[model samples]
Target: MSEKRPVFPEFDPDEVSSNPSDNRSFGDVVATRLSRRAALAGGTAAAAAFVMAGGSAQAAPRRGPAAGEEPAAAPAAESGRHGLLGFRQVETHDRDELVVPEGYRVQVLIPWGTPIQPDGPRWLKDASNSAADQEQQVGMHHDGMHYFPLGRGHRGGDRHGKGNERGLLVLNHEYIDQQILFPDGDEEMTGEKVDKALAAQGVSIVEVARGKDGQWRRVKSRYARKVHGNTPVTFSGPVTEKHPALQAGNRPMGTLNNCSMGVTPWGTYLACEENFNSYFGTEDPDWEPDTLQKRYGVDNVGFGYNWHTASERWDVAANPGEVNRFGWITEIDPKDPRQTPVKRTALGRFKREGCMVTEARGRFVGYSGDDQDGDYVYKFVGDRPWREHRRAGRSPLDHGRLHVARYNDDGSGDWLPLVHGEGELTTENGWKDQADVLIRTREAADAVGATRMDRPEWLAVNPKNKDVYVSLTNGSGWDSAATPRDPNPYGHIVRWREKGGDNTATSFHWDIFVLAGDPAYDEEVKLGDNLFGSPDGLWFDADGRLWIQTDVSNSSQNLPEKGYDNIGNNAMLAADPRTREIRRFLVGPRGAEITGVITTPDQRTMFVNVQHPGEATEAWGEPTPQNPRDVSNWPDFDPEGRPRSATLVITREDGGRIGA
Candidate 1:
């Protein structure tokens, strides 16, 4: 009876158990029963040499194609195809919708309560709208996006002009389920349902265009805004003057759980504030907590979005600095919807999951990822260099030089420098300066030793070889006394290059570009046509073609006794990193989660994002009348409705581009 544990042992509610035949949310039966108890305590040739060098060969990727060959034909569409060239890889689907490929099409454009301003509020089928009509509509789960473009003039578009054909999408509304946004689910969590779930959590922007029949719609413009969770925003760098709970005249309100985003090459829009400590709670006792709130698992049982009964700044003992103004990196300026969103804070808050940026030799680097489970890997750079004009109101993420990575078991790494008086970041290692080394950036990267990883989330880069990648997305409680390596439990993709290929290089070299699981669990490092697992959203595009989404675990799709049944759903592969192939492009819709991809710089549109579909059955909350179904209605399954969370688009029916 002595094995109870879990008071949030870093959340293992049976791994996101809203239950769906519970395969222990991505732990695939606790990593196949800890690989059969480490092959009976270190035998079976030491657990097959630690699962083939924990996913073979310093994590494969010295150029593609080899793991089961076949990748070769992709040079046609006007002799300029990109990524996984000549395309033609698409077979896994538990189908509820979206599949893509064969000339591509997809559609859907917007979903989660779409309205796009102009006095919003009109999406109902029981979403009962109104937190002022979801702060004038369109917000809820549609994670990470970007598109800016407008009249082909500027703002990350105009690959050949008129192609982006008008934009300003922006996205990221990350959370809110309340049994699909209330109608009395869990008795509608109170008061205008927590003010329409805090106006359906942050960031939206809208404004899409294209139609003369070419598709892409959502137009209403006035820079169609949304930025919820109470919107005010401000803070800029050095934890807004050394965190006394982030000072600078106290501005920091909105932006929540935004997840995977980053645009700026002098165009703004970064979002990312993942899992905002699950919308905080813990009633005041004079709050205290610390150790960066227990290494960011922050408890007091909150993700129930009780929102401290509708605000006491959602409690943390009544505003213990509003969870330090939500894990930083906010930014937004999708062509100014009356500008305001700032955060930035020298880019160093954990739980961040996205932020890519890139400019290299002229500074402006970026690249984050601290999405839990043994966290680490970060970047930043930019003290000043990226001048394509923006001095009339500065903000290259306010000022940088963050760092953090470490790796080194030889394949090389090293970045460190979270600089607070440097070296052991000290006041004898208490780090009391650069905003306490950027608000205790994971205890100053575990006081300079770094390298914990195995759940880092996005970070793409590689516009034709700037090389950066990183996804890692699956970790499930390892530490049966350390030493397992490579981002254990079915998840990989590391990549690196830095140094001379400078992104302000502190040092680099890294490897491991694909070791996701179940191609019969590593037949020499899987992938012979996409046998994916975990690898959460990494992008690339503009003709570099890396893509790769995943997130698998709708009870391990198609469930082959919970072991990644030959990669059946939750997909969107694409790779090519110079012929290290990896195909299967697009395959979600059964329990969703094929998160945000993005394209259109005339790569002929693309988009992606699926997130939480039929979230493991049990027909979501509320909706009675003899169980009026609501778990997987999806894009319009409407068995009484409720399973939104969309944003697709795709294109190429004959227009070209898009993984041609």
Candidate 2:
């Protein structure tokens, strides 16, 4: 269908041959979002005008702040309402250290292998930590996270009071770096190696607070704990009837590849299971995946994890049903470890990314995306409101309707319900009931003609106007008019306003918020100074500042030929919703992707994660012990040190609001 292209074996593209072609692309809506004539002009005023219009030409004006919510935390002199950025913008660079604007400082906290408890095993620089030790230590590749104030009850934006000085930080460990994990450098597989790798993923809940010196430190509280691949998980929602595919002994063994996350109004943490299929493989050399398994990406040989070699738990040939128990949205209560982690099946599953929940008409409405190219975005609408559901001793998450999004060529979209008897989701299509529909959510969305997105990664809701935003992490197809480059390496973010400003509305209007790329490579650069690619994680602070995190693949971070050399390292930027004004706030170390971000209630202390530093062990050259030059060895500057993923706490020298 097109000209010859470079071969990338690891590239995950939209592979469904039967899927409808998506030509609406950035060319269609982006030009309309700015009026083709205005977009080609590339003038700052038109960009600001589009942003001030709340992303969509048909969208209503921005709504006022929610009740009891804090006031907008920032406003610099001469910036107008949202014009002036509070912090100096940091330039993109390839330094081996984390950098922030002047007058602000960064302190590395809780690096990987740090003991969860003070009495636990300390990290050994020689990579000799046992599998058991990993269970009690910080996990690898820190991602989406949140800060809950200590000594208080969290309820739907209520922190019980103004206690942000101390809190519990809950984060996700996406995956492991096998190259650095084993001292021998990816030697033959073993049960112990699999155990250690599995134990380093899932979620980490650790108590941390600022000391008298204003430095944050991890606290050894009773609440500090780790939930990993060995942790027992329970099921809830429409698919809790002990389906055969979900048979993993009496209970499911664990959650794998925990990526981005979300939080419920009642304060429970939602850990998204992304790339869960990589943990499964078949012992049978000639094994093949069934239709359902194929759609979910189950294969005979998994991206080299090789867990099946040592553990039947991951051997799909031995226990094929076990693979179905994963790919779910796991809920963990950080305050009480006694409560079991619940996989909310009502949300449906297909390599779940981030689940951002908002209160829609006293009930819960959750938004999530299936983080793969040509996948779909979904939302769950609860039937019962919060107060009534809680009084009746029910979880709002356990009773809801999940629907996939369908975008039109115009600037509008629809949420088509995935019910058992609805449309093609009937018994004739292999969907016996709602359980089957959710187990194979992707195909159901496909059956209903859902719009295939680039690589929907994360979703965030605005605090000021309740609008929604999603970061599409590039694609192998779908050419964009905003950029002239081929292959569209850098993705863009989209914003939408529900019909009549109601989050529960089944229809909405959308527009392209921004397209990210470096013009030097013949691709158009939309957001200057805040230039970035591969937008992965997103969050909106109390003051309505949209925080964006980049996830440039480690393989291309330093390669100029891949079109990312101009956008060095990864970075975190802050954007004002009212204007297209965006400023880079932080830049991570070489080879690392800046991910997972949050700040205190007062917006004073901010936490950002530096993940996978010193990645891609040399592609332009070969490596040897005498000249083994890794991309970077951050935090630990010793020549013999290993790069470790960690969280950093940033605060102003004057203790003022963050992004100020």
Candidate 3:
């Protein structure tokens, strides 16, 4: 049978178009492509060699004894040397269960439909839970997440606490599967069906505790809360005044398509609203769509959620302004469950993958990706420096300066401010004010000539060096007659050092850290045993080891026709930035995306989320106890069992630090 492809969110025109001339309209030659495919296909060997050597340093010379001399013995793990040296790389697998390194063990922590509230309805085997039950229980399709310790004050626990035993796990539920979410498949749109779907898409904050034996489990606590798509939210920033639809007294209810996330210095969570334009319909006559809406692909035929059938708020034609409420970074306070999530407007509206916050020169700075091919990278600088005592009051994200990135062919880049009065972003260019510049960020970026990237997914800041790393996922359609850009069929990771080694700097130097692809496809750049593609879900541990996760499509996994076929399945990898050595750490189940990774402050226990397992399966015929048609029944590989997305806790068998 043919593999069923998953329907992802809509892509911007620039992301899918083949005309390279379209990129020329922005007034600059596209930055040189650093992808391995472009390198092998016919770029200069010197350039390819530079990329293989990690772009920053040349390959180290062999330090061992000569052929006639004896080689020295390797050092022990307990020695002063730190980081991922003790753990062996795990081979890629295409099984239906989570796979980890030999010494590491994985346990299923929290699965979707698990009840968070004491009185919430329990998960039924047949998947017959009600909309109210879903709202009270854990939502579906877990994505990005963070762990906040319970008794360590608002600052969280120390990195070497006694196991860092307890904390609140805040995770995002990206989307839902109608066939699996509803007991009876959703063949028709009903208020009940729509409600259940809505209840399954926002964020979940659950309290989890680790026992004396090192096992972790979710427990009922006052802090447990569910912020779904129907919850009420307030809009902040310049958008409220710039868009009449978001004016006073027009509070938007809930957030949809929450993809990736970030934690603020004040300890709040920032859940990104990605692909939100697909949730609303454009049939209302009163709604007049603008160029921005058209560019985002907002149209009459919705993503099939059909929320408009039961609620007018989902009808953009009737309430055109409502669309403006989404696409902004949402701030949620997990400690205070009753607090309403706030839409932070200062970050600028876009299909954000998420934002990563770090302190630089006493100020708070955030980096985020638009998550579409040909889109620009952005950064927001808070107006004031972060104060330890200010955690009780206002959010630092309320006021900030947003900037887009412009990369030079020589490995230098600058952050062009999105301020209205700035160059190219003036009245003559159709930017009326700061709000207008932010509301139409893509257009403003085009005007300023920001560099176009291939589906920037996640941003991570190295704890040791403060350098920033971004995952540029795979893309195609670069071969055009007018102009030709690199067709990065496989993904790669890009790292940049901020000018003067400061996170707030507007200028920086960058290099291709690692070109991801099958080793067989690229001989010169291949880092044996570490070859992987479509880099996504990046984070750095306290020890500064970068963890990279893969998100290969179902049709591409194990297919000989694809470049990544040799890399069994979507997996996670660890890399030491100093040496540029990337090693595979774990491989996730088939047809699932490995995402949402976080470890305890003690660095002993780690949590990783597996999203949408069995996504490639066809849901047809009547449901029965004998057989539940599934392409992959992960977590519980029972033939008749229904596949559910879940979280896995990984620990070392020797009771030592993870990845040691």
Better candidate number, 1 or 3, judged by lDDT: 3
Cα lDDT over the full model 1: 0.67
Best by lDDT: 2
Sorting all predicted structures by TM-score, with the top scorer first, yields 2, 3, 1
Cα displacement (angstroms), candidate 1, residue 364, comes to: 30
**Tens-place lDDT digits, model 3, residues 349-415:** 8889989999987788999988776676899987777773256476678767999887665445789
* Best-fitting candidate, scored by TM-score: 2
Better of 2 and 3 by lDDT: 2
Q: What tens digits encode model 2's per-residue C-alpha lDDT throughout 1-660?
A: 022222222364222222344434444334444444233223233334434434543233222134443223222322444353687788898778888999998999989999998888998766789999999999989988988887553323443343566788999999987777766655577899998998899899998977878789897798999999989888998787387778764357678888899998888999999888887887797788888888887788777778888888889878888888888999999999898899999899788888998998998999998887667789999987977888899888888799988765455678999999889888887788999889988888888877667678899998777889998877654433322123556777777777766788898766566667665653234454457888889999888889999987765665566667778878988877776567888889877888899987777789998898776623333322232236667778667767888999999998788886
Instruction: Write the residue-wise lDDT of candidate 1 on 49-138 in tens digits.
Output: 222332243223443243344333322222324435666778876657777778888888788888886456678867677678778778
Clashing pairs in 2: 79-84
TM-scores for all predictions: 0.33, 0.89, 0.86
Which runs in model 3 stand beyond 4 Å of their true positions?
A: 1-83, 152-163, 241-243, 247-251, 282-289, 388-393, 477-485, 522-525, 617-629, 638-640
- On TM-score, the stronger of 1 and 2 is 2
